[model samples]
Target: MSNASRFKFFKSHHVPTLTVLKAAIGDFSYAPHAHEEYAFGVTLAGRQDFFSGGQFHRSPPGNVILFNPEEVHDGHSGGERALDYLMVYAHPEQVKPLFADVLGHERGADFRSRQTLIQDAPLRQAILELTRLVTSQAGSCIDQENALYRVVERTAQLGGHVQPSQVTHRPEALLDLAREYIHAHLEADMSLDDISQAAHLSKYHFLRLFRQHFGMTPHQYVMNGRVNAARAALDQGTPLTEVALRFGFADLSHFNRRFKRIYGMTPHQYQRDIAR
Candidate 1:
């Protein structure tokens, strides 16, 4: 087995209920262990073989693997080439509502598979996008939150086991209040406590409801608001440094990095493109 490998494990800074793993392993095997959160991943390259649900399964590039909470499984490289992939472990609360929405219900349905492998191109792309957004520091909170919803919606639809809830509940008033506060304070230092207070919710309850309602945390919402404001200013030929500071970024380099990550170009490049 080759030894050129890397592994990283971390939580999403913007969405605290999410955890992420990015790994490239040439010679490692996992012991049978279970997670308290739902686990899903996409194979970026190479091959991985694992045992679950009374059978062995192989996942090649562009394939997806899913495990419901507490499902036991083990994995290893299926070939000499390293296995490169990004995996997400999400809390049940973060996913349940999306599943409910997709199924046209509001309660009592869960992913009904033991170890599921998916090869649908669109679903794979959605999962990849969700991993990218949740694990990256760029993009607005709304973008990340929407991407997350897409992943859950696609996954639940593909699974084909969602049951409709008897009643539907909406929290529009609270969500609107939160949005109003976030937009009004785009240039200020917005904290979870402050945003939650504005919504008259406890921090924990606010995080869950906010994510379910808007698909992002308060911090992500504020950051995205700032980025959007910066984009508008840049479009009008605002000086890059002034735009960055005026929109709440600490400095020009920080703004440049964030802008490139979200818009796929630096501020100057974007301005040049717009001019032509």
Candidate 2:
């Protein structure tokens, strides 16, 4: 396939469920086109006029834009300032499962079609942070993915203000509590049953709900939590065995396997890498 076809294919599928690209370039105009994925992003620093749906909109710095998949749109600079922005391409299929499960909705209507322009300082800062994480090569992909969700959450919150009925269930409170519990109990032997009880949900229900809320199963979340803790402990020169026991792993071998699975390196190697 040609480059254009390849781009289209990736946009449709094969790319990660949600991914981002940060652009820095001179003024350029993109002819009208559409993709079968959500095109949502922030106009970081520059001026651009985008024509979408039935009208033309000029987007400047701090403008948040969201366009539905396969929507016809074109972009051209408004003036001399070069455009630099962060763009996240998300598959509706990926978003659909989470929203459906979390908000107890069958389908998500386009409450903010095309895009909701967010200009709040805190919201903008959060978006920038996500953009940085997404575009940075050295940062962890898991961390970047989580940051991307924050951008989405903030966008939804701000947009909901303009359209009062758009806000979905704000379950961050519950998720935060569960996270704190996991951190406090990392050194103790805990199972999915234990965490489910802490989250105040039945085992199967909690597994699905936690994934919907935090974008990962409780097991994956705790594994990641422990891995992060182990990394810090190792950095502080904690012994490998202690780190394993502190994180509730069965043994050093088990912890090492999981650490390698996530970080692609053994615990000792990770330590050496950090030292280097």
Top of the candidates by TM-score: 1
* Predicted candidate 1 versus true structure: per-residue lDDT over 138-188, tens digit per residue: 577777678778877777767555333322444557766777898788777
TM-score of each: 0.56, 0.47
Tens-place lDDT per residue, model 2, 204-241, is 87777777665456776667777866866886778899
lDDT at position 46, candidate 1: 89
Alpha-carbon error at 50 in model 2, in Å? 1.2
Model 2 CA lDDT for position 63: 78
Model 1 lDDT vs. the true structure?
0.71
Q: After superposition, how far is residue 122 of candidate 1 from its true place, in Å?
A: 1.0
Q: Model 2 reaches what TM-score against the true structure?
A: 0.47
Model 2 ranges off by over 4 Å: 1-15, 25-27, 109-116, 138-142, 159-276
